[model samples]
Target: MNDTTPDSLIPYDEIVQEALRAVVGRVLGQVEDAGGVLPGAHHFYITFKTGAPGVSVPPELRARFPDEMTIVLQNKFWDLAVREEDFTVSLSFNQMPSKLVIPFSAITAFVDPAVDFGLQFQAVEEDEDDLASAENDSANGASERDVASRITSSEDGSNVVSVDFGKKK
Candidate 1:
């Protein structure tokens, strides 16, 4: 008559997150296979961890974002290269051309506006110490852009599909 849910050793959230990231990889791979052609007005908005390990971007952009940032893969992006661990693409920001290399582990959200299909993830949360450090850094030097992008988009009425299996109290 044990009715309580036992805590399993398996990390279900990490496993599910890994699988979902593979979906993003597969979709991007399909686009790569199609010679980087986004089919029939389909465009993607990808949000990722700017400070995640293995992520590479210009210093200025990092200073501007300082945390997470979203990029649109639509009419203007170029040099879409997908690799096993990461993807690199060229995009323009404020008319300045730049290249971004992002690891799959860094991605937190992906959306295809044409189909209104989206996948949102429970991205790795920062540790308390890290959060305190970040807060200190922001207070000392972070800019408006950095503060702006840090805003979460849970209730924006966008077509994002997010799944949260949090326990109820």
Candidate 2:
């Protein structure tokens, strides 16, 4: 009797990740359809990799947050644009108005505290070097782990999707 399990050739992780990202897109699309007005107390905390491909942030912001950044979309946000692969919005940072373009693939965490719903995604790196580079980058004040911890703490009736894959080596 062999205790070892063979790894499947299917890319289930990627498929699942894409499906989860679509959820984010659909939610944003709803907001977009509503003329950028968030009904009631529904707000979002979106965290993404600042250095990821197709990400367009202000130069100063990119310099300040070289690795990851989180933005709140509750009030004071305008020009909300949602697309299939990404979204763009205008937000104010320290009294400076700026527009940010973030792709779904760059998103790492999305949380709506009003409904206690959150989703955390794994950062997809192109190669081991990119992974090492990202690991060495400066840490953000609010990380995916922090978001997950906060969301999971109120686990009574919360809807949080956080998948952890353990790769065999």
Candidate 3:
């Protein structure tokens, strides 16, 4: 047998990413079905690319975030509508209400701290030439800090699923 391993013809990385995104969709759909009320002690911290295609955020918010931003869906959010490709929800930032349209493809991380469950996705690069220096910890408000800390504090790696497909040389 040959010593070197050959790359597969199938696009396994994309396929896996698509299927994993569907999990986020299904979870959001369940919340929508329940009249937008999160179950007891269940909330979400979702991080996504602010500049990604099909993502809609207020001009000011985008200006502040510029690259990646996280949002919390808990007691104050409303208008939770989940569709096949994306989800739209209204959230308050600095007491200013705004609606966000985020495609599942843009989501980088999703965490539910109540159950210690999280999922991290690889961001789709729109322009390789555009290098952003902002950190992914940026969020709209103070509460997101808690979520971010919790995610990074995990030492045992319990329920978080992170997929990284390395490039073939």
Candidate 4:
């Protein structure tokens, strides 16, 4: 392992991150395919970056959240649609229904309260100028605001809860 150069190929960190993102997609897909009832006490608290590419959310929400937002998928949500790169769902806000389209790449955390299972990821950085411009854009202005308003955790903990394959033999 010592002989291997770091730049030789894709890093394991990225590979693991991608794989974990896939888990989010698969979970959402299952909910969509099964007509929306999560079995047992399973529920999810999904936290994602509001300004990430391919994320679609209302302007008011964006303005309210600003940087990152955590959504609970439990008692109320609808129109769940899962795609290869992202997922869309309709949820109520102040009794008004709102739709959100979130890309897997935007996800920072996925937590299931039922079993205290959780996965946290590194927040990917983008070009600062582009992000600033996007924040100023009318179309996503509200979302950017929302992302900024929401609270974010400082701890970027383990990406998976169930397994610890990092142990050396």
Best by lDDT: 3
Please give, for residues 1-169, the per-residue lDDT of candidate 4 as tens digits: 4754445354676788889889889988998888998988998777778888889999998987777677778878989999998999988877779999999999876767565557666665544532322232122123534322221322434223332234243
Compose the digit string of candidate 3's lDDT tens values, residues 1-169. Answer: 8665578699888899999999999999999999998999998888888889999999999988887888888889999999999999999888899999999999977888888888877787645643332244434454544656655546766587877778655
Give Cα-based local distance difference scores for all models: 0.71, 0.77, 0.81, 0.69
- RMSD after Cα superposition, model 1: 6.1
Stronger candidate by TM-score (2 vs 3): 3
Which prediction has more favorable lDDT, 1 or 2?
2
| TM-scores for every predicted model | 0.76, 0.83, 0.86, 0.72
Residue 31 displacement in candidate 3 (angstroms): 0.3
Ranking by lDDT: 3, 2, 1, 4
Give a tens-digit lDDT track for model 1, residues 1-169.
9666676688887788888888899888888888889999998767777889999999988988777777778778888888888899888877789999999998877767576567877666554433311121222233434323333333656455555556544
| C-alpha RMSD of candidate 4 | 7.8
Residue runs of model 2 more than 4 Å from their true location after superposition: 126-157
Error of 1 at 71 (Å): 0.1
Please report, as a residue range, the 10-residue window in candidate 1 with the lowest summed lDDT.
131-140
The model with the greater lDDT, 2 or 3, is: 3
Collision pairs in model 3: none
Model 1 segments more than 4 A misplaced: 1-4, 127-160, 165-169
lDDT, residue 160, candidate 2: 79
Poorest lDDT segment (10 consecutive residues) of candidate 4: 132-141
